[model samples]
Target: MSTAQLQYQSQSVAKPYFIAAIGLFVGQVLFGLIMGLQYVWGDFLFPEIPFNVARMVHTNLLIVWLLFGFMGAAYYLVPEEAERELHSPKLALALFWIFLTAGVLTIIGYLAVPYATLAKITGNDILPTMGREFLEQPTITKIGIVIVALGFLYNIGLTVLSGRKTVINVVLLTGLVGLAVMFLFSFYNPENLVLDKYFWWWVVHLWVEGVWELILGAILAFVLIKTTGVDREVIDKWLYVIIAAALITGIIGTGHHYYWIGTPSYWQWLGGIFSALEPIPFFMMTIFAFNMVFKRRKQHPNKATVLWAMGTGVMAFLGAGVWGFMHTLAPVNYYTHGTQITAAHGHMAFYGAYAMIVLTIISYAMPKLRGIGTAMNDRAQIVEMWSFWLMTVAMVFITLFLTAAGVLQVWLQRYQPNPMPFMAAQDQVAIFYWFRELSGVVFTLGLLLYILSFFIKGKQPAAQPTAA
Candidate 1:
């Protein structure tokens, strides 16, 4: 097989991080399936893996794997964008193992030990940072994460500062730094429920809706410049517009979460207006993607990467922009709060915006990393494209099914004059849960195919004649 020369040797360190991200992504999806089953079957996992445990694992794995993907992306692109080798490839590799081990041990602790016992043993009482939804990692594990994050930021930060300063590198570095800072809120769990929930959004809402958009825009711009052959100036302008809109709306959009959480009544107006405007950046991203592709200067051989890039734009708009708008208004959200409606938005938003961007980078960079060429062979590309459609379509149906269930839940439990009990309303929506489970099964199959594509061999090139 023909191999292309890698631009930088230190970029090779990203391979393990990407590999770990994919592996943990598989774990996340499996736990998702388990939780989906438990929703309808009630006792499916029984004593072994209860719904709460499955949910904790599912959400935690999603966070951990996405972090891996982000780190891998930074390692891969920062060196090239900076026009130099990584500042510390050795540190990058060391952090990868540290993160992987800490993540695995944390997950095991969740599964093997009960939450209360695990908390006690892990010294949560001393710090009391355990048991919050999505922030369930033991205090010790959280500290480990902080250490790893600081080391990672130090490595990437130095590399970017020393090299050529490009918009892409600067934006990515800014987002990463914000990510680390926002995570500190998880440790500041106050006794007041309102305050705890308030700051929780700093890490959750701000990461996904705020700084992560910067990361997403930067990655998309880089891919567009490469695949579409668009000039960096054109892409940089679009990126600036998108991230500006994202920050303006996203920071104020934090009020949307404050509406019912014992916050002031003014939040109803502030959150409603700002959150409604939150879709603008995502919509611009969709337009930017198609505009660049339509104006492409060259036909890139890596059709699969291009497809993922386009899908990220469209799906993100539909998921984060459209669906989010459906229930973001305080009045509307009052009815849908904590219902399956929220689940609908989360399912697609995370997959389309964060997960797809991560996979897009991997798709574009993996072939180069493996010395296989600019892209995978036609066969592998075809399989990968298939996996993309399968997973994407499955997630759509999952969101639809959940939305249907949420509508019924709101009507039966909240809107009606005579509301049913929570369990009773759940019984009315069992069919949708069953449908969601089926969609989850298809999604898992797609993920399996995606992993399989990595192993599929392409045709070998004939050898050149030996020198006399």
Candidate 2:
């Protein structure tokens, strides 16, 4: 097939964004390793970088890179899905640099000065959205985010609205719009601690469990249709069904975070019931992915991308669904609320769902972006696959070790009659922290290999049949 005939010119806008995403992803992993070590060493960076600063950078980078991935995915897909070019490729490019510059500056501010100094320098006292967990971005930075999101939405919205409005494109647009809208709530941080916590979940939980799932679904559907040569009609209908299932369970599942807060007592049952069902959509996603691949009409040469897509389905279910359900119950959460179990679920869930999906899209899209044929060559792909297993396995061990630590900590500190003090409990769980840190090191190695695979030169593999 001719490259021009098969590719959209507007898709080129995504290349830079993906490149930035990968670069930030590496930084995120490195910071992650640093934080993991801080868990065991306590004084690894101490007053210089501090565990909290490293953690904030690690998490904030994760969110920023994922946003970059989402934007890239939209830029790449909207044109094709709409059967027309982007409304403003130049605008897209402009926003790309704007967002990237803003991100780098914010990160520099984060590292170069104390957070308080950074906040004062950024004028956080003007609106005071700082010091609130995930809303740590200065108010000015938050406004920048909103402006960027608006520009993004406008660009994507016009393209989708102007051309074909396929199920996938419409869903993606809606999700992006919803994401921006929910983020606005972060600016409304009242002084009441209960009220503060109450609305915090709106930005956090709603994005991850709600609109983000829609984004994930649409991207997965697009990839499946392209790679599997599945009927668009069939796949489109399934997209609606999957998204519907996601919203039905996930919206109510937001109640899960309300239990311990100063909210109504009935939230326990509501959260338990709804969050338990939240896994249904993820499970359906797994089945939908495999079934589509099994019934594929074409043998796509990019086996690595196929692996990524399928892995997103399976790992998202296991990490976000199964592990989430393990403690989402109000009773279980009451004990494991702030424990390492939450950390375990969080690490796995974010990696399995969001990180993996972004990587899946990039894996499928990058070769074409680079004009390197349908995918990376067999040798590079083999190395990429190796990184995938190494990272995935390392994450599994990290989660397990954290869970073990959490269980022991809960038993010794929370559940025991003569409960140990918090610091003593931490000391008791030090071994598990050591294990988690080691696993993080392995995860970093895997990440390094992943970066290296892109540079490997090798012959492209012939198309292989989809597995039975």
Candidate 3:
């Protein structure tokens, strides 16, 4: 390689974002494991950590880790995509540490005693804030999320504003903008109103389903086209298809949550119709990725990148948009709204669509950052690609099983007027809990192995003749 052309040998000059990402991923998996266990043995792991605490932990860590990973990817990607080094790596570094500290501190506060601690501080546990334990979670963590959002948006905003924007760059910018806008809504404290659910859904629903999904699909397609030697035109078309579909379907799909809330029966129709089609883009994205790669002019033989993109597309379909729409109808959701079926969609969509996309970007960047050529790391890539598939597929199976179980649970509880008949309607839904716990273990194994391969070194490039 020429002196002028050697890609820099790090995620960037300062790597705090990467460190933050590492911390978030660690937290995500560990808490996720604990959450899985709580299902199998209900009394097995509370007080040390209550189920609501675990539930909040599980949910927040997912959002936090993806933010961390995206931050790191931004540091790597903005510079490369813009063809300019990051405008302020120092600011980026500070943002990482700030978020890292805040994320940890917030989780600690969540675990420590939400009401009593706040009650002691305020001199009464009866205060509105002290009521639901989950409320305590966002109190501190919300600050952390806001700070992280500012740091990221400022960095990306300045970068894109200064540089020549490509289609990929613009797509990412739109996602970050949506992320920033959504973060503000997270601070809303809807103490007296039932409308808070709809409010909360704006941030959660719009960010993931609408904007972030766009970012995810765009980045994945970008990596695949560059790596797979496919025609750029074909890949860009896939990107457009997914983005348009996710947007058209996602914004209104917030109605799914509005059904039982004080909203209206009309939303049932709105949410059901759009959400049913939300999965279309994801389904197309999956078919689009594999079809592109399958028709590649020459196979690169790197299974990881190949699998990463493919798994992302497939899981998004099965998990996020598909499973969600299954019970999305007002009639059906009236029974299944709060049950385990909801969880099935959560695990798949986030893991498949968002999680896989972030990893795909990392897989692409790791090789570039290490100064290795694609021709060599292709083998290690295969290991990674398959790992993505196996883990996500395992999650899909787990989710499907639970969804079926949740269906049964809802049947016994909703249809039978004697509501207390079952143990929380059939032994407190014990069997489904156990199934979720076991499935979580399988997921943990997949993540552990996926993390392990980064340490196994890939082959170095063979020396080339010096340019004449």
Candidate 4:
């Protein structure tokens, strides 16, 4: 083997991490399909699965995939950042198995025993399991997740503390730290409903909106600049811009959730005002990608991945961040909470912004890990890029349709007067749901093609990927 290949083979980054990431990817695509279909046909495939059950699948899959992908990236990055070999390849491998096992088992439990099963499984009735499945995490599963997080944190944290810390490394480390802290939220007992929501927001919302997003935006900008040969100074500048905007706005944005719950009146004011700026970072991301591409020092042969990354950054901000802002106001969101519009915002934002960024990282590293001298097969990149656009645009359409439906539903429920009649409102909004279902079908096709890309061989050398 060549020097680089030999070094790669002996290193922690050399194996296992990629396999874990790919597994998460497969699980994620399946979850997306399940969630998408459920939205369209409502009762078609998921009658057996239940809505909340499908929800846990969808949301948890995203968390797992992103977590695994981040682990893979950290494995790759930590050593590079430290300017030395990893502390322990064996430990890295151990973490892969531990985390992978924990993630997979958690999802399986979700499928087989959703919270509703708690009463039957454990002979307990006072605890409501079906609505909030976290209640069902069995002490074992909760402990397992904690163990996995600790193992990962120990491995990554050691590498960072012992190694050099660049601006990029600092940002990445911050994200991992945030991830570790956030997992702590999942540890609490769900029986405390109000407290559970508070903790849930801490784990789910804070990680995505605040810390990890900064990590995502930071890492994504790093890849774009590195690959495109843009000035690091410019790229880093953009990173500062996006993270600053996302955090300041996102942290306070938590207030939006306070509207319905038994909370102080200030949350309404806080959440609405800050969340309105949530899209600013997303908007900045779109500009960052396009601007970098336009001014690239040299054209990268892998046009498709570049396009997809940029597309994801832009769309995530617009679909998830911007549109989410529109109705998030306490005044507006009061009626639309738990509705399809929220679903629409979540789908586009996550897939477009967060999911795409991780995929972009995968695309960037694939050729590097394989040790191919130049670009991989351009054809696949182009095809994958097309799939990216198709899926995003299609999803946007679906969200738009759903948003229309949700607005109609909200207006009918809130304004038309309760006794004015359920039948009248139901009759008016029936067609919107039909439109959402139709849009969902198109979105599903796009996702299928995305999943297919993984199996299709690219033009690059066909060797196993290094996990780091």
Query: Per-prediction TM-score, please?
Result: 0.97, 0.97, 0.88, 0.86
lDDT of 3 by residue, 351-459 (tens): 8888887777676665555445443354555556556766776787778777877777887787667655545664656776676667767777777666666666666
lDDT of 4 at 236: 76
Model 2: clashing residue pairs? none
Residue-wise C-alpha lDDT for candidate 1, range 1-468, written one tens digit per residue: 222546888988888999999999999999999999899899997898989999999999999999999999999999889999999999999999999999999999999989999999998889999899899999999999999999999999999999999999999999999999999999999999999999999999999999999999998998898888888899999999999999999999999999999989899899999999999999999999999998888777788899999999999999999999999998899999999999999999999999999999999999989888778878898999999999999999999999999999999999999999999999999999999999999999999999998888887332222211
Residue lDDT tens for model 4, 322-382: 7788788887787778766787787777777677777777666665566553345655666
| Candidate 2 RMSD computed on C-alpha atoms after optimal superposition onto the true structure | 1.7
Q: Which runs of model 4 end up more than 4 angstroms from their true locations?
A: 1-47, 118-137, 190-192, 371-374, 418-431, 434-438, 454-468
Those runs of model 2 whose alpha carbons end farther than 4 Å from true positions after fitting are: 1-6, 462-468
Model 1: lDDT equals 0.93
lDDT of each: 0.93, 0.91, 0.70, 0.69
Q: In terms of lDDT, which candidate is strongest?
A: 1
Worst 10 residues of 2 by lDDT: 1-10
Worst 10 residues of 4 by lDDT: 1-10
